[model samples]
Target: MLTKYPTPKKLAHANLSKLTEILWNSSNGRFGEWKAQELKNLAHDSFGVENCEDIYSMALLTMLDEIQSLAEKADELEKKISSLLKNFDSTITSVPGIGPILDACILSEIGDVTRFRSADKLAAYIGVDPSVNQSGEYTSDHTRLPLPAKSRLDGLCCCCAA
Candidate 1:
């Protein structure tokens, strides 16, 4: 059913390059590649810069770097979350439809599974929940709709990758 397979890859690559440029500029190549903590420092310094040209370059480079760093972090987090999920003892893992890799994807994206107070909320967040409409005595079922949260959609993709 999918027709635009290459589009996503191309877009992803473009975004990564853009992000790398931003991060590269923000740190002025000082932070190089490994700059998780340094990013925080740069963010703090962003507010204090006075020169327009320097600020312009910094902003551009920071955006580029942020993209690259985030991609790396997400990849690392996926692996780490997968390992952790494999050891977790819960219905979330033991359930017939859910596996460790999928569970890790959800966990990493959701941040904390405990934050979800109900199963419906969790399902809805993942964009797996079907839409239901009811009026008077009429009830209607609808197809799966897009998740309102971009992060939730990202999490779902993460799960699919697993």
Candidate 2:
């Protein structure tokens, strides 16, 4: 789709039916008439960009290609990581909402939990353990809490959230 109409002006002024057919065909019929109209409207709205057709466009195009290549490599790396993670009996992977890639990355970072003396040490290492406030013989238990926001709507308001 971009190859056919790389410039905003060309896309904005393109014949409606032709653009729709190209978009439809390019997307294998997934993007139809509505998407074409949307793109056309978007192109019309974003005009007077000289760089779109200049030497900057070539650089932009090259960067886009590089991004696509990097994305493919990342996906491949993720699959390899997931496969590698299966060899270890990780409790992290057993937890709800935790996936293989994340577990693999975390396990790689915090290798061999036995190295930490205790669970508290692990928690402190990960920066989750809270610090206690103490001074000489006086130990403070009070923790500062966030102030409640002012009520935008009083009891007279119709909505519950408001």
Candidate 3:
């Protein structure tokens, strides 16, 4: 991008049509267009942040370290789940567009696949089955409202989307 606009200020004020073409590509577009317009506005208004270096305080850095540690823990758990999934011979992952993590999650929720007589039964158990919204006066098309019995709501989206 620097080949076209060499400086931050020059790129900052680049015309909207050209900027969108360049940015793949706000205010009206808000994140005010990915904070670029906000930057431009700040520059135009001569706005400045005081004591920006204070952002690097020990408290923020400690939280960042904790976040990194948690991320690593999550990755470890994901790998463990993927490994555990291999013991089950079910072809749940054979469904296109679904991945091992989702397959593992849905399978873990449904413990024994053989318990369900058919695919429809499995889908219903996973909270993906749509139910009629009807009263004496009105009825709406089938909508998926998560069953109170089912604690994991993510299954609704994963099953339907898959």
TM-score top scorer: 2
Q: Please report how far candidate 3 places residue 105 from its true position, in Å.
A: 2.0
Judged by lDDT relative to the true structure, which candidate is superior, 1 or 2? 2
Could you give candidate 2's per-residue lDDT for residues 1-162 as a string of tens digits?
A: 665576777788888899999988888999988988898899999957575566655666677789889999999998998888878878885665567766775676667888999998765665445666678998789643222122221211112223
- Please rank every candidate by lDDT, starting with the best: 2, 3, 1
Tens digits of lDDT, candidate 1, 1-162: 011111222223333344455567767776544453344344444443344645555565677678879999988887787676656544556555566656665556666667889988877777666777779998876555655465756656555656
Task: Output candidate 2 Cα RMSD.
Answer: 11.3
Q: Estimate every model's Cα lDDT from 0 to 1.
A: 0.57, 0.70, 0.63
Q: Which stretches of candidate 1 lie over 4 Å from their true place?
A: 1-101, 141-148, 151-162
Clashes of each: 14, 0, 5
Error of 1 at 157 (Å): 6.0
Off by over 4 Å in 2: 1-4, 15-58, 94-98, 135-138, 142-162
* RMSD vs true structure, all candidates: 15.9, 11.3, 8.7
The digit string of per-residue lDDT tens for model 3 on 18-108 reads: 6545545213343424455654555456533435524434445667679879999999988898788788886867877666777776666
Q: What is the lDDT, from 0 to 100, of the residue 42 in candidate 3?
A: 52
Give RMSD (Å) of candidate 3 vs. truth.
8.7
Q: How many angstroms is residue 36 displaced in model 1 relative to the true structure, after the best TM-score fit?
A: 52
